[model samples]
Target: MKTVLIAGFNGSMGQQAVKLVNSMEGFAITAGLAHHLPDSDPTSYGLPASTQLFTSLNEIPAGIADIWLDFTVPTAVYANVKYALTHGYRPVVGTTGLTDDQEVELKKLTQDNHLGGLIASNFGMSAVLLMKFAQEAAKYFPDVEIIEMHHEDKKDAPSGTALNTAKLISKNRPAHQTAPDETESLAGSRGGDYEGIKLHAVRLPGYVAHEQVLFGGAGEALTIRQDSFDRKSFMSGVKVALEQVHTLDQLVVGLEQIL
Candidate 1:
């Protein structure tokens, strides 16, 4: 049985992880960190009473944890991920808003240290498939654009999902071509463009997570979309990462490699 230490073990995803481990026979939990959550919020989320609540990662005791599950905020990511590696622990990070440059540096650190780190922008299998499909289709429809939406409380604009999607799509395709427009009235009317491909971000209440890829062709158009209505949808992808962390000693950025 794999032993896990949860970083944001008081939140929605953390709670789900607890239940998954509790119901499953092959895994056991070592510790849980609930730094920023209210005392009562974690109860419904399935955090055990034996779990210790702390404001920092420094409080975690050494030599007992196998996997460090991070479901915390983006700002806390670098510090915690570093701590895990320094202490010879594996990490499965689901936090967003970390920069591309930061990711490159983390990958290097994971490689140099020979420690495993899994960082996923979106932990939904369908969303992963959407990215894969877009990447595959990019060769045929090189003029593809992306639109992403999420809950209003989410802090990041142009979420990691959209950025990663654009990056993947950009890798296999040439920059899309748009006809020159002589009309100029509203500045920023065309929305933010990545490598000549348009990207739109929407933030509103009552939306979980959604993304769509619009591919334009000569007199023909193709569209691909994926949506997650509830937080539980991400658990499957998280499970996959946790299962794979043991055999890896390198930084894995996407779930694509495991899939």
Candidate 2:
């Protein structure tokens, strides 16, 4: 069985990962690391009696687990992933907010160490498919815009899925593709612009993670959308990453590669 460590084990996504790994075979959780945990026993989250939980990464001993599954927030993600790599733990990161430069550096470090790591923006299968679909559609429709909606509690604006979609579609489109001339009376009404595509973000209650890619042509428009109504939607992708990360020779940044 492969040993596992969970980061952010108390959050909704973390809890889901915890439950999933517990139910699956050929995997075992050795420890869980959260910012803090309430006064309770480990089994409360279905952890085995041998498993432990910690609030700080430093508190854990080295070589405690073979790999780490990170569901932490963006601000803390860089340091957490670096710690895992430096300490010889392969990491499967579902955290968002890593910049392009951070990704490049992480890949180099993983290669240098002769290890494997996975950093994914969205772990929902439909979301990954949406990104691929948008890239394919961009070859035909050059003018596109994106709108992403997530729960208000999500800290990052312009969800990682949306950013990845824009980047993929941007690469397929020609340079200097222009949108129609328009005027915005309000300062931020047009949303953020990446390449030539407009991106809008929405945060509200009662939403999990959702995105829509709208492509406009002369007389018709095509919209490709995906909705994740629950946190469990991502568990499958996380499981896939965990099972497949060790097979890589370097860091991977998207779930689409494994799928």
Candidate 3:
């Protein structure tokens, strides 16, 4: 069995990871790491009594887990994954705020350690497909924009999926301005720009996770959209990563790599 260590165990996605690991046949929870916990009692968090719980990175014993599954916040995720890699744990990261330089550093660490790791921006199949489709559409239609919506509590703007979509679209679409230079009556109304692609981020109480890629060509327009109604939609992709991560020799970004 592959022993798993879950970081940010108290958060929503972290709790989902806990459930998914427990339900999988060949995976077991070895420990949980959180930035802070009221009590050390494992039962309080619905974890097994034998599973070790740690509130600090330094306190986690090395060699306790084979895989480090991270769902921590943007602020803590980079450090958490770095600690895991240095301590001999394979990282399967779902947390999305890691900067490009941070990822490059982590990739170097993985190579030096000869370890396997994955950092996925979105772990939902629909979201993954949407990015793929958006990349394909960009080749034909260079004029495109993206809008991503998530729950209000999400810590990052221009959700990782949206940013990743823009990166993918940039790969196929050349660098060129799609819209004319116009001043907005209100400042900051055009959304963020990524290599000429306009990316709009929406955060509201009722939304789960959704994205729309709009493309305009000539007199016609095309829109591709995807929605993740529940967090469970991501677990399947996580499971796939867990089962296949060991096959890789270096850290790679995107769920599409494994798929």
Minimal lDDT window, size 10, model 1: 36-45
Error in Å for residue 254 of model 1: 0.6
Candidate order by decreasing TM-score: 3, 2, 1
Candidate 2: global Cα-lDDT?
0.89
lDDT for each candidate structure: 0.81, 0.89, 0.92
The digit string of per-residue lDDT tens for model 3 on 40-87 reads 987777777898998899999999999999999999999999998999
Per TM-score, the best of the predicted structures is: 3
Which residue segments of model 1 deviate by more than 4 Å? 40-45, 178-189
lDDT of 2 by residue, 82-109 (tens): 8888888999999899999988888888
- List clash counts for every candidate, in order: 0, 0, 0
Candidate with the larger lDDT of 1 and 3: 3
Where does candidate 3 stray beyond 4 Å?
Answer: 175-178
**Best candidate (score: lDDT):** 3
Which residue pairs clash within candidate 1?
A: none
